[model samples]
Target: MNVAVGCKVRFLNDVGGGEVIRIIDKRTALVKTFDGFEMPALLSELVVVEPAADELLQKKTVQEKETAEANRKKKPKSEVEYLTDDSPEVADSSGDELSLDIAFVPSNISNLQQSTFDMYLVNDSTYRVFYVLSNVIDDNHTPISSGILQPDTKVLVKRLTPEDVSKLIIMNLQAIYHKNIPYKPFQPEFYDIELDPIKLYKRGNFKRNDFFDIDAYIISIASTKREAFIRHLTDKAIVEAIKQKEKPAPVKEVKKPNIETEEVDLHIHELIDNWKDLSPGEILKIQLARFETALEGGIKSTTTKRMVFIHGVGNGKLKYEITKLLSSKYPKLRYQDASFKEYGFGATMVFLK
Candidate 1:
């Protein structure tokens, strides 16, 4: 980014955010910090700020501070407890030892549309990991953060802007894993982690997880082991024994119901006596099964010509589902709305002959 005299800018990787007072060269610039100090910073690391946008950013910060202070003075209320490593339910996990992921925690969960995110490199295992996190732009990797992450912990790598979250196409995670004690070695991994920027816009994408105190969007980068193991309250670990392969079971042909009558009542109440406790989905499932069975049998019968399935009109969901299934699965079968005079817009008639 090109910088001119008296340009407002913020340092990308540092705490000091101020304005650019002088342009040193093409690659360097002199920035006046908020603390009244002139610091030589790289032009690449200086993010230019608009005056109006900067005002709004400062206002938002003040509002957040006020809200935090207000909450502190208010009457104390019971808070929901989330899972932590100290919790009894989170005992030392036996399987899937080397878990690794990059977690994105929203800075403002209430206002997700404009919220920034604190990105974290999480190492949820016993292995000491050396990782380099990079940003991939124009097929080139720009180094962002690199460190040795301790076992079962996470480090905040970068605080992402709203624009950064929206344009998050991809990131590169490079890592090598090892334990201090005697252990099996893992090959160095170079992961090109793909991300959905569109989904990041939704508040539901960030969730309260076992790792972070705040809700986060965690994308697992790698795990060193995939072997399944059983855990018990003993010094020894258990492994499943090898068993002989059993003979394959014979597949039974589904017996389709013979639709001998001119009409098949596919309603839940008619098909089953105990459907009062069933959910709408369960009811629809039963009706579809009955419809399929009758249709399959009707098409193959020699005498049966026409079949009318009475699926009552309730928001047209069942009718839409039935028609869509028939059209896609039985393209050759001719079907239409049952005679309105007889069925009153509640049934489908199929020509099987």
Candidate 2:
């Protein structure tokens, strides 16, 4: 049977089942096992468990909620995981069993202009959350407000700008917890979260909130926390990187004769020292090779705006060959007779564009 990503499937050879993460090809697929191991297996080696992933995802969410609620009564005070700002968003027991979900809801007024997106910090577990919201602006963290969020309650954290939506910045939440049967309160925890820019603008990202009676961006801080990694670079290096990105590449500069030489000489003797033993055909070949090389070099250069190739008035053969090559191969370059005051009718001046 043909399978697609996000479908639930069981391994034919193994006793375990998993969700299909990716369709590698016609014959292969990447499966994410229930035990969290992702492995590539042949399509024939898999059997469809659930064609729709939404059912599986809903079942998993309900199971987690039941588990979190059951742990609320029997959770130990000292038993806790070292929670950090940048970590996976797996809900854990902190003696009193607390779980927080940070969700962003966008304004969905049909004709609304410049939406002021709303952010909600929800307390899912049975404990009250004392929360503080801070905004990171211009490399500085500014405190917005602090309040106590009751159990199974949510509070508006802040309104976001479109500029803020596109950036990496998000509200930093620091909070302590409280419970009626708790031995001691849980320590303050840090969480960094931001709505995905691509998803934030999408109409599907927001759903009709029966509670709020409007549409909003709902970001779940349930399964994973955004990483708080920063890159360190010197000012000079940053400036150089910006310049490289914004600036177009410059043309290479070519070497040219000074005012004394006036033009490049393509004569056989000027091209090579040992030309006495060389045949006339070989001499002509060497002169043409040197002339082609000089012409290409001048064309690639920004400094050499105009250059003259002195091939001499020898039977007009060399001149005719150079003209034909320029017109056919190097059609972009315009060539004509050199200045009458300088080389007279012998040299050709090639204009480099």
Candidate 3:
């Protein structure tokens, strides 16, 4: 007899009746009862059945409600009184006594394995041993502990050799074929020696002729006239250090100053008195000079006020120059072609900052 996952089956014998939970293989089935205990049994020992009526009825009712809702056209009511007929208090406790059918199986323990430096006890009845292994142990070892194992925690079990058991008890040794093996100590690269130059030079710094050959240099210096070699190397090192100290620091780049001319707004009276008859270019030059003077004055005064360049609307040359200068030189100043009904396009408005 064969069973599959979620197959509905009932017990044939009286060894605790339940539904089949899963199929283990061709002959076995994992079954669970409504009371929550589970077991593996032969498929020949159970009978297949349709699902119970209570479950079928609940499913039918849900399907009917969904069908009704899908066919309906009306929008759902938002207010509680219109949406639901039941009182809030009765609705709250309606599902309190509902119980679900669930089952639990005994956890499988055969996959647990002993780790290096782990101990175990053998259970005589089942020929299986229970023991705590280091969580670091290989997965192949049997009767292993779950999660993190605490020191000195006794694990119950069976079916391991005495040598294997003894190896587990020894704290710092790896268990190999049921025997304890001591850990090897790691050695340091260089130990207990002074780095003298005479010893370095004799080791042949001249063979490779490489400047970065530190080890060869050390041996060569140490082998040859030791004191003189040390003094020469030390003096050379000092001279190199002094030369590095004498080298000049790098200089930072400086930005060039902007040389474009600025636009300035002259007083209406001043323009009439001293600048009215000048040509457009001459008037532009005067305006630029005035712009520089005004900028210096504003900076010194720390005031941000509007200055109106009252260039009348003749050919619009002066206004154009004024606006161009303002954009290039005094870009931070808020500028616009002056309002027509008031100053008209003949003047440009400069907002000082």
Candidate 4:
């Protein structure tokens, strides 16, 4: 690339561009940037910006060259001026306004029953506040607005309706504050405060009145001044109360019904009430059903190896039916007359396989 003095060129390895001032050697040239710093750059390290914007840029480059030459001609050369991004130093200021805080208060102190609740963001401390109020929904922090809050004053950010009160979520606050003194201000202090949703919006949850004239939610952010100790336990208790729901009582276990004794009475009076009104045939059928049920139970039981039925020697008809059922349905069973000492010739004991 052919280069000459007063030509605009860009630094190949760095961000900015400047005008070439003087060629030091075959490989190097001195360049001056717009911010007024001159440095030696390699000819290969710069690329000439083709078709420079106008002749005015070339004129400015020539004027800079003249200024550089005039400064060098002085008896004692002036010190070279370098540009940077740092602010100038200043002395620290002394004041009692050395802290910052964020707070909230209701606008109408006299009438607390208003439908539309007007709330204020109060800058309770002396330092000016630059703050952002973010609605923390889910895991995201969405900033509503950001601005400066003057000390000891309040800014109304919301005139909330009753529905707005319920729609309230977490308020994620981040702020940096410093005393607004002319001298070098105090180092900016950072604050991150998460306002509880219930306490921040729900009016019925207010537990104390020490910080405000009326019952209100006051958030304290890094303030050295003391206010009421927040009743976080109260909020916790309210949450617990809301979460408490009645749980159904645990189900009771039921026991399986089984034959109560080795000897089952098939007599109608023993099995049911008011058997005198039943016909003779109905009584016999009931007695046979009980006998069949008891025999099935004995057959299925692991521990019940024998069952004795006291059919009371009823004309031998019940016995004939019982014997027929055992022979046909339960071929694995055997039967004989029960003990004469206990049943007196009326009971029969059936044995299960």
RMSD of 4: 33.6
lDDT of 1 by residue, 203-271 (tens): 777878998778888776665442222112122110011011113559888777554547888777666
Tens-digit per-residue lDDT, 1-353, candidate 4: 57677778998876677898666568777677665545556788899995344576678668767766774676364654322111112322344453333444544534333344544556656656666666666657786545555456555544455455555445556666654344334444433344444554456544454435566655444544321222222444433332342246597887663443478887777665656654444556666767776677777788887788998874466777788888898787789888999888788888774
**Per-residue C-alpha lDDT of model 2 across residues 1-353, encoded as one tens digit per residue:** 56767788987865687888766557777677786645556788899977866676567669757776776656687866432221124433344455676666666545223565766777776566667778866546687646556566676555677777766665577887764333455556665554456666666656765345577655443321221111232334433433343345487887754632236787766555555755443455556666776677776676777888888875576888889888899898887898889887889988885
Give the local distance difference test score of model 4. 0.59
Clashes of each: 0, 7, 34, 0
Q: Report the Cα lDDT for residue 28, model 1.
A: 68
Provide the RMSD of all predictions against the true structure, rounded to 1 decimal: 21.1, 28.2, 35.3, 33.6
The per-residue C-alpha lDDT of model 2 at residue 249 equals 48
Flag regions of model 3 displaced more than 4 Å. 1-280
TM-scores of the models, in the order given: 0.40, 0.32, 0.22, 0.31
Tell me the TM-score of model 2.
Answer: 0.32
- Once superposed on the true structure, which residue ranges of model 1 sit more than 4 Å away at CA? 1-13, 16-96, 224-353
Question: All candidates' lDDT scores?
Answer: 0.69, 0.63, 0.38, 0.59
Scored by TM-score, the top model is 1
